[model samples]
Every structure is written in structure tokens, then in C-alpha cells.
Target: MLDAPEVEELTPPVRTLMGPGPSDVHPRVLRAMGTPLVGHLDPTFIDLMDEVQELLRYAFQTENQWTIPISGTGSAAMEAAFANLVEPGDTVLVPTNGYFGYRMASMAERAGGSVVTVDAPWGKPLDPADVQDAFDTHQPDVFGFVHAETSTGVRQPNVSDLTAIAHAHDAFVIADTVTSLGGVELRVDAWDIDVAYSGGQKCLSCPPGASPLTLSDRAMDRVLSRENPVRSWYLDLSQLEGYWGDDRSYHHTAPITNVYALREALRLVAEEGIEARWNRHRRVAQSLVDGLADIGLERYADEEYWLPSLNTVSVPDHVDDGQIIDRLLNEYDLEIAGGLGDLAGDVFRIGCMGHSARPANVQYLLAALDDTLEIETPKTQ
Candidate 1:
């Protein structure tokens, strides 16, 4: 018989998460996760689920009946939204601005969609005219883009115009708000976004297991009327809706612990008030920018298009990004991320999301960053 696995005392580092996601989980949320586990279908748990759905609606700024937490991570929410909405052979207009935008295109393609991309340079917002051109060119059945491009810290300002263009063309607009949902301004109903999905880890400050997904009435109608069933059985929104809906049927065992964490996090959002939370994030982000500038760091994204939650700081020439990130981790016990895909090595992705958006955390990051760059930076001033 195989020997029993060795056991040891469990301990984890107290990290200051100033990176892209899983931003420092609040102590209250961590405690909520430790509460005794109840059965997924227990009356108390079901009540919690109801509250969770309502809170998600408040966060997404939508009254859509289908809003609920998906079982997997943020990517699962993205997949479910696209798979349910885009059927085989559907044309999807996607923006190619940053990593998550490209991810949307890839997911659509995997769902058998013929993708027509509206290309934009990294660190820049999508142009409404270019989106209009894509609509004219493809007349796609679905339109999708990342509202906040996490990789480059760019926020799309043409959401209203883009959604209008898609609506005029009779196309359903899907939005990736993974990094923006609770950290930035998002109005699912007012913006006319048909489907929107986000991760709990970033702005929500929950663990990375649960993802919030919402579909507008029109998007739900499209899902119900799809000629072909959604490709992935696990991600079929129409069926999963029953479980999360008032009927309260079983789909898969909902991530019970994650549900608890999310509920607490959402409650905190409620306690703080949505508008206040938005203002706090903006204030903290401005402080971060000011501090970085004081240390001679430049932001990759222009101010008008910048996302307040995730800031893309340009890596000074000749500085080894990996080296700096490592030193930050080893010495300061803080974490900041390197850029993804094309922007890798050119930028450092710093985040001011959820609980990590406090002034103290931002100041700590600035100090550590200054120390990390001391060697790479030349003496002046």
C-alpha cells in the first residue's frame, strides 16, 4: 500500500496583491469562507444564492433575470456567454486591441463562429467608426469586445456607440468586463450590452473560482430561440438558468464556499454603496498614477482610455521586468504582474482593485517599485 501523504502545518503568506487579479481578499470574506459548510441545496444556502443574484444585478447595473455566478473562473463566464449566444456559422465582430479582446475572438471562433476583427493598436480604445465599418462589412450576428482591456489598461469609451451600431445591424453585443465590473463604471441595461461577464477575483475581491455572468432580455430571447443547441453542455445558459433561477433546480453543485465569499464581497459592495466604491477606486488609482509619475514611471495607456483598476506602467528601457517583479516578491512580499502576450516585457500591470485599492497599499507598491528600479534607473535630480 502507498504510504500516506506527509502532513504539515498550513500557513500562507500575507501578501499585498497589487497585481491584475485575486486582489487582496478582505478579512471578512476570508472568514465567511471558513464558516461551516452547508449543503448546496440547504435552505440557508439557497437564500444566500438569491441574495447573491440580487447583489450581482446591483453590481452589473442590470435587472436581467438570468444573472448568476458560473461554477468556474472568469473564463468560464466568457465561454458560457458566447457559446449560448453565438451558434455555429454565426459571424462575430471582435476587437483586437488587447489580450482579453483576442480571447473573446478565440472563444467565438471555437464556437464555430466566423470572426471579423476590428483591429486597434494595443493601449488604445476602439474607434467607433472602425466598429461601424466592421458592422457594415460583416453584418455579424454577434459583436464583442473587452470593456476594460486588462493587458494594456485601456477602457473602451465607445460602448454606447458600438452597442448602437450593433443594434442597428441587428447584432447582439457581448461585453467582456472581467476587470471592470465592480471596479469601474458598467451599466448593462443603460449601455445596451446584451451579455456581460466578469471575474470575482479582480474588482470583486473574492477567490478566483466564481464568475458573474448576466444576459439582457434580448440576449436571453436569442438563447431561447437558437436553432442549434449551445456547443458546451456544461456552459449552456438556458439549462443552467433553471438552477440559478427561481425554480432553484440543481445543475452542478454550485461552488458553495465561493458562493459564500462572493456574497460577503457583494455585501461589502452594498455597504460601501456602488457610487462610493467607484469614487474610491478612482481616488486610489489617481494616487497610484501620481506616485508612479513621482518615481519617473510612465503609463502605457493614455489618460482618456486608461482603466482605473489596472494600470499599465511602461518598463523603462534596459530594465529587466522579470528581475524587478522577482525582487518585489522576494524582498517586499508584494506582487505586481508582467504584461501578457504582445505587451509582455514592455509593461508592468499594476492593479488597484477591491480591498487592494487602499491608499496604504498603493503607497507600499510605489515604495517597492522605487526600490526595485533604483538599480536600473540613472541618478538624477
Candidate 2:
């Protein structure tokens, strides 16, 4: 027999999350997570599940009956969208502007798709003309784009136009709304998006576990009628339909605690109204942007395509991005991030999402950022 290793009680540092994701979860959401877990298919749990789905519909501004929460994190929901939609030998088009577009390409490839790109520069939104051109050239069967590119802090505009272009080519459209849902203006039905997926931790202000995913009837039909079996049995939406669909049977154990937390978060959304939530995020983020400007920081993304939830600011010539980031976390218990991929080390990624989108949080972040910069600036000779 072996003795068990002793470990200390868990006590993590309390951080004011203002990074790209897993933003400050609402207090109500945290309280919900502490509630006792019921069986995934318990009678009470089933009813709660229905409530969650309905609330999700309101959040996405869609009437799709197929909306439900995925059992895992946001990426799981993202994979479910790709794995079920892209069949072997299908040509899928994805954007090349930011990191998540590459993620879409990878997921599609894993689903046996021949991926093509609709090109745009980092920190820029995709042009509808480029999407049209790609469709004309490649005739892809599926098209995917990030509604809000978290890496570059660029929100894609003219979504309806992009969807129209894909529709004209008879291509299915998938949107990555991981950073935009609830905090940004997104309309699934009005925009004619065939499928959309998002994370709970972003604009939802819920801890990451259960994620939101919805597919239009047309998208669901394609998924159900796929020629080959989906590569990922775990993420296969067809199998998942048994649980999330009307039958409400068992597929796998749902993340009950996360579901509870998400329910509370969506309740908050309903209470606030989605449009009002979007306005709040924009208003609060604008304050952050203006304060950064006042402190001599330049915005990395253009104003026309700026993502209000995640603001990217250009790093000063002599300032070390990592040093400032570390100081903010160590000294102030605030969390912001550096850029990813093409924009790495060139930008600071500050998030104003969900509960973190309050004016107080913005003011605190701006003040802390200003002090960090002042103290960390390279001394003049």
C-alpha cells in the first residue's frame, strides 16, 4: 500500500479577468455553479434544459429549434459544427485574417474537407468581394468565418452580404461567434447564418464548460444526411441530437454544473435584453478605448471593424508587452493578454466582455494600465 500525496487546500488568486476569454463570470453564475447537481436527465433537469434552450434562442436571436448547449468548452461546440457539416472530399472555405480562421481550416480538414481561404490581412475584416471571388473560384460546399476575430479584435461587418454570397453558391455558412454572442449584435435568422457556435465564458459571463451551438433546419438536414460518419463520435451532432432533441435521451453525461451556471447567465441576458447588452458592451469598451488613446496607446484594429468585446491596442516602440502584462497581473491582479499569431507582441488584447464590461472595470483597467506603462517605460538617458 502507498500513502497518498498530501496537497494544500485550493485557493487561487482572484483575478479581474479582462483577457480574450473566460472573462469575469457574473456572481449569479458562480452561485449557480455551487448549486447541487441533479442527474443529467432528471425530470427537473430536463425542464431546466428546455429553459436553457429557449434562453439561448433569445440570445442568438434565432428561432431554430435545434439550438442547445454543447457538453464541453467552446472549441467542442466549434468542432461539432465542422465535424458534422463537412463530409469527405467537400471543399470548405475559411477566412485567413485571424487565428480562429486557421482553427476553422484545421477542423474542416480533420473532417476530410479540402480547405480554401478567403484572404484578408490581420486586424482586417473579410471583404464580401473576396468571399464572392473565393466562391466563384473554388465553389466550396461550406463557408466559415469568424464574426468577431478574437486574435485581431476585428468584428466582421456586412454579415448578411457574406451569407448571401455563400447562399448564391449553394454553400452552407458557419459563423464563429465565440467572442460576440450576447455582448455583440448578432442575428442568426435575420443574418441567414446556417450555423453558429459560441463559448459561455466570453460574453455570456459563465464559466467554460457548456457552450452554445445552434443550427438552422437546413443545416440540421445536411448534418443528418451526411454521406459518411462524422469523424468525431464525441462531437457528432447527429448522436447528440438524441439528448438535445425532443426525445431527450442519453448521449453522454452533460456538464450539469456548467449548464446551471449558463442558465443563470442567460437569465441575466434575458433580463437585460440582448440589444441592451450589446449597447452596454459597446459603451463600456469605448471608454476603455478613449482612455487608452488619452494615455498615448494606439488602437490596433480600425474603428469601422473594431470588436467592442476584445480591444487590441498597438504596443509602444520601447515598451515590452510581456513585462507590462506581467506587472498588471502581479501588482494589480488584472488580466489582459498579448496578441496571437501574426499580431503577437505587436498588440495588447484587453477584453471588455460580459460582467467585465461594466464602467467600473473599464476605469480600473485603464488606470492600472496607465500606471504600469508609466512605471515600466524605458528610462531616458
Predicted candidate 2 versus true structure: per-residue lDDT over 229-262, tens digit per residue: 9999888888888998888889899999999999
In model 2, where do residues sit more than 4 Å from their true spots? Answer: 379-381
Summing lDDT over every window of 10 consecutive residues in candidate 1, give the lowest-scoring window.
372-381
TM-score of each: 0.97, 0.98
Instruction: Give the alpha carbon lDDT tens digit for every residue of 1-381 in model 1.
Output: 999998888887778999998799999999998988999889888888889999999999999988899999999999998889888899998888888877888899899899899999888888999999988988899999899888999989968998999999999999999989888999999999999999999998999888999998889999989898889989998888778877878877888999899999999999998888888999999999999999989988898888999999998886888888888988998999999988988999999999999999998999888988886643232
Worst 10 residues of 2 by lDDT: 372-381
Residue 1 Cα positional deviation in candidate 2, in Å, after optimal superposition: 3.9
Instruction: List runs of model 1 lying over 4 Å from the truth.
Output: 376-381
TM-score of 1: 0.97
lDDT of each: 0.90, 0.95
